[model samples]
Target: MADQLLLKVRTDFVERVTKPVISGLLDDLLDQKVLQLDEVDEVQDRYTVRADKARCLIDTVRLKGTKASQIFIDSLKKRDGTLAEQLGLVAQQGPPGDQLPPPEPSVGIQGQQQWIQQCSLSEYQRIRDKEGDQLPHKKDPLHPRTAESCLSLSSQIYPIHLPRETRTRRALIICNIEFEHLSWRKGAEADVGGMTELLEGLGYVVDIHCNLTSQGMAVVMKDFADRKEHCTSDSTFLVFMSHGVRAGLCGIESGDETTDILSLDTIYETFNNKNCRALLGKPKVVIIQSCRGGKVGSVLMSDSKDPAVPAPIATDSTPAGLEDDAMFEVHLESDFATLHSSTPDTASWRHPKKGSVFIQRLIEQFRNHACNSDLQEIFRKIQYSFGQFPRQLPSQERSTMLRKFYLFPGH
Candidate 1:
């Protein structure tokens, strides 16, 4: 009998031999809905199958005396020497019409059968190793049930797919230009008009209130927070323009003798989920364009013949909550953000004819980038625009947010 020697095929040739066989098997599996292939790379002889489906394929191929492995080998044999030659596994077939020598008598049928068996084992081992690597790992610590529940709750809390309806958009814009004894804000009216136009263009139905006292401001905030419209809205904006002090925004009642103001923390708590369930899981954007302190920002002047003249200064400056009731259940608050015009203990600048430096830059930046950027990103650009001036830096505070919030202007 001829020597029973193993035919060593190149690894590349082995890979080539298994490609078509595996592809055919995958097609059958796919047709039966037994497996799903998310992605496939025919050139690399690799494909990604759904995790569960991969295990099914492995189990089916590894059965005792399984004919699937044999079927793969038989398919390769049917291709004759074409696949082998393509992968350089065997010598190239002779030119067409070239007669070959007859086989020797010692080359028995049993020897050929043994060679076929060896080839089948080689192909099976290669596939088993490759498929085994594709199996999903059991490294995740979280149980599937816990992960699924988390995903479900997250989707419910933050539904990004909901339409941006303009009719549902709401904003409370309070501009305090006239003070009882304090100097009037030169450009506060302009700030209010600009904010109204900008917010209305962005789809908000703005409620403009001029010259509100501290008590009036509190009443307005509570009423707005309790409105049913907020329940159907995706987001809301609260803009306050007035002279302010470090302690809080100065109201009309604020004067030289005593301070009449609203606490910032109180304003935040009023719109919180605990107090305002209607706005829960929705973005509440509060923008304050006012002086946060008594100091004024000044710039160095270049040498000139003109006389030095005094420049006007600007100033800064909420709070309310819901009554507890036995029948109402409290929900955790989230997704509140506050954008202050000036940093703490610093003065915000404004022009007599134009608006405050912060509001002007804010309107311009939002109009330019609102369609493409999120609210946080737009605020960053606004802050950068104020970098040229001295003592004017905007600040922001954010509560826990399940998902990013976008203004989606013009939507």
Candidate 2:
């Protein structure tokens, strides 16, 4: 009989929910001593169980459309009221069938005391108006508890909170246009203007640095990383535009010598958790607009007069730690992303008059979608835009990000 009851309930559960869910439920019921296996028939689906003393096996097995149609309704209500209510298996109170109890007439405070007593203190307070009259008790959509719950859930799901315009929004734009020996980049300065304008419009306090040597670049980056703004800000952007090779961006080394290359590894290490604790756990975006190599790409010209431009330059895990042989420490690192102008060993396109193809497309796409789309999606669109042309394809690298990062430009 117990086996028949278990088999019936299991069948109903599988039919209504899923086989996997029913399997879990069966295990839980067995573990909780609510049901015990009695016998297993030759058929895989047939099972027998011994129910608890309080639970009736006969009522628990019935699945017909009679008065006791729902099996385990009482047991489910006793085990998990919320789950029973969600599954619509809770037994109706008052009269049976589809008939519900008639609504009670409006009553005074004396008659409503029992219902008011069941409410939380804060909820009860909200029931009264400012004039102290007992107002109709309506649920508050913006209650403090509700807001806190939502925030808590969001934080758990998306650990990093992308900074808003109201917070400290800072961007560093380093454009090296003038080289002593090499021909000066024609449109490098224009790129700075466009980038700065776009960033500022998005509420960033843009700092532009022009024609810096390798040492100067390092100093500026270090200083910026240590800024108090980064400590308080939700996110930061570092944009570097100059000549470059596969190793890194080229800084001026005594005029035209490209010997002074600021290595990409060094840049990453500088902003890492250990060095730049101020920006820890916040999104750090690095945008580079420099050539990575000498390989140039072919362009398919359209009917439009715009000339096909040459490639312009471009531009963690958690672990446990022990201290003092007695204490254990844990550290987590995340939320860093880099957007490169082109793939490794490839030249990035630049327009001598307009700007680098990457930066131009970036600014346009950001303006169009920053308010609605995430940073990754916007970058993907920029890459798509370059697909029509030649040579310049953007690439992105990201560390562990708990949630999506969005600029929310113009917000």
Candidate 2 C-alpha lDDT tens digits along 1-411? 222222224323322443333344444444544445641111113322121111123222331223333223444455556655554455457333432222232111222322112233443233222213322246676653343244432342223334342377678887776666544666665576678656655656666566667777888799888888776577888999887766677775533334677878667767878888988877778898887664433441111101232333333233455441222111333566789988766667777767778888888887677655567778789889987766557888644554566554332
- The residue-by-residue lDDT of candidate 1 on 72-121, one tens digit each, is 22333344457634533233245322212222322122323221112233
Output the number of the TM-score-best candidate.
Answer: 1
TM-score of candidate 2 to 2 decimals: 0.53
Off by over 4 Å in 1: 1-167, 297-332
Which whole-number lDDT from 0 to 100 does residue 98 have in model 2?
34
Ten-residue segment with the worst summed lDDT in candidate 2? 300-309
State the C-alpha lDDT per candidate: 0.56, 0.56
Q: What is the TM-score of each candidate against the true structure?
A: 0.55, 0.53
Worst 10 residues of 1 by lDDT: 1-10
Model 1 backbone overlap count = 6
